[model samples]
Target: MKISFLLHNAYGIGGTITTTFNLAQALATVGHTVEIVSVLRHRERPNFQLDPRVGLRPLVDLRQEKEHPQHLRPAKVFPAAEYRYRQYSELTDERIGACLADIDADVVVGTRPGLNVHLALQAPERVARVGQEHLTLDNHPSRLRTALRRAYRRLDVLTTVTEADAAAYRRKMRLPGVRVEALPNSVPDPALPPADGNAKLVVAAGRLVPVKRYDLLIEAFARVVAERPDWRLRIYGKGEEHDRLRALTESLGLSENVFLMGAAAPMEAEWVKGSIGAAASNFEPFGMTIVEAMRCGLPVVSTDCPYGPGEIIEDGVDGRLVPVGDAAAFGAALLELVQDDERRHRMGRSALDNARRFAPGPVVAQAERLMEEAIEARRAGRPVSQDRAPMRQILVGRGYAARDAVHATGSSALRTVRKGRR
Candidate 1:
């Protein structure tokens, strides 16, 4: 079978890019003709490695910056419903439409909500239309949710990374008979040996975004440092929250103990440097780092973030899950594992064994089976009346409008500001 993946940009180094490439490579290894269709290419080549067996195609080359170099202008062909609508243009729409209209693949997979919207509208019914939701349904803004409610009716199947997320989609969206399943992101086992649980280090990774709640982690780590002066914390990845987090670390007298390692490539090597992996995000769709760290044999200590950590880590088994935003609890979990080498090592072993649930073989086979089922269901002309959204928009002509989406974000921000004032 010919399998195609549609992505917003294949050049970036992110969880979605990493997972998509992993699955595409796995499919190719199993003898399927797999291709990645990148909607936009900012660089000459993808940051992540691509398998020789898989085909790579870019629909719009943004390296030279098309008609509007800045891309701050509103979109013409790209649907306004996509979160990054302002970055697209008439050029992107034409290229994507032209490419999808004549594609002959057996299954076309879209990796994000925006690209999924295009797949839903453009892909011929002959091929199974599969949409992968890396983020949780609750994380989506109301505007995007509205658009998805309308657009996803066309998809044969939709997959989420966590069961909690899958349940949310079934309860909130109108997918009718559309099969929604929780398919964890596949992370290949590390080539090197796993962490030995001897290092006095705890590591965390991800873009330094505010939603990651590094502030909470810093505070929690300060408490850990107070108790265990020999232990240190290292945070990987760079982002806008750098200054703020750095300041917090300094003010807490943790500048010497906590180091910010910016965007380390080959994160597996970094994971092995520490005995425990930590993530204190206030909210996470799925904690890819937690799995990556576990794969390298480091027991993870993470917040019981929405929809992910609880599902990935069996509390007190492979790792420990603390309540979100609880510094004392976070610090206590860190200390418990830090103080007890025997238990940490035991959990580390269990972590390595449990992480295989996301191994390439099982994950890819699950995806393949879903694709086959979706194709069969589509071929039978199964009506989606059972779960189609009551208010489906006619997006066959005009692109999704941004007016409502902007208000959705605006209202969310307003609520946050209001809560802060209270």
Candidate 2:
């Protein structure tokens, strides 16, 4: 099978890009031909290391695209929410169609909402169209939501990272022909060894965005520092919230103990240096970082966020979970782990055991089953199954509740529609 992955920007380092690259490589290794098609290329260097077997193509050089002079009273940035709506309204050229003409793949998967709508609406009739969502439906703007409702009815399968996200789409869009599935992100196992001794260090990593809530992590760490002055916190990754978060750290007099360690290359190496991992997000569609840390044998302390953390951590077993936005509770949890060396080691060992479920081999096998199911359903002119493996069954078996069974079964059931080749 020839599979084409349509991504918004393949040049950047993001969870969506990393997961797509990993899945594509796994599919290729299993004897399927895979190609990546980027709609916009922003940088000369590819941030992800693609499998040599995978083919890569770019449709538009965004840097080269003509723009109005910046000296003029600047309108909002291109590709802003308003600009995306305007682009949707005035669909002048069929860029997606032109790109599809360049490839003869059995399946074409779109990685984001705009690309999904474009592929569903514009692709020829010979290619199977699959739309994958990395964020929740509630995160989309109203205009994009409306467009998805109208355009997605034409798509074969609509995939999201979480079951909660897929359910939201079903309820909000109310589209008949669309099938929603949950396909969480997967990462390769870490190659590094765990730290031998207590590093007295906690690590947090992600883009410094509002949703990531790194400020919350800093505040929580400040409280932890008050109790255990020897422990330190290090946050990796750079983004818009850098200045504000830095200022907050200084205000709390945590600048010395809490270091904003900017973006690090090969993040897995950084995880090895920490005694524990932290994920302080308001909502995580799928907490890839948490799993990454676990894979590196670092016990994690994450918030009981809406979808992912509860699924990943087996509270008091592999890791601890505090209520969302509760900095005090988060601090106490970290401090407890810091003070108790034996508990941290026990939890770290358990985390490694729990992470096996998300190992690339199992994850790719699940993906292959989903693809086969979608293809068979499409050929038979039937609807793909949207019923998920029960979270309760998975959690109960693992001695977890609804909130602590994140790693149970990360499977999705998206339908595939094939468009005829020109």
Query: Number of the top candidate by lDDT?
Result: 1
Clashing pairs in 2: 125-419, 125-420, 126-419, 126-420, 127-419, 156-415, 310-403, 311-405, 311-406
Query: How high is the lDDT of residue 88 in model 1?
Result: 81
- Compute the lDDT of residue 387 as modeled in candidate 2: 60
lDDT of 1 by residue, 72-181 (tens): 45555455766678768767777788888899898899898888888888888788899999987888788889888888888988999876788789888968767887
Q: In lDDT terms, how accurate is model 1?
A: 0.82
Best by TM-score: 1
Cand. 2 Cα-lDDT: 0.76
RMSD of 1: 10.8
How many residue pairs in model 1 have overlapping backbones?
1
User: What local lDDT score does residue 167 receive in model 1, on the 0 to 100 scale?
Assistant: 78
- Cα lDDT, all candidates: 0.82, 0.76
**TM match of model 1 to true structure:** 0.87
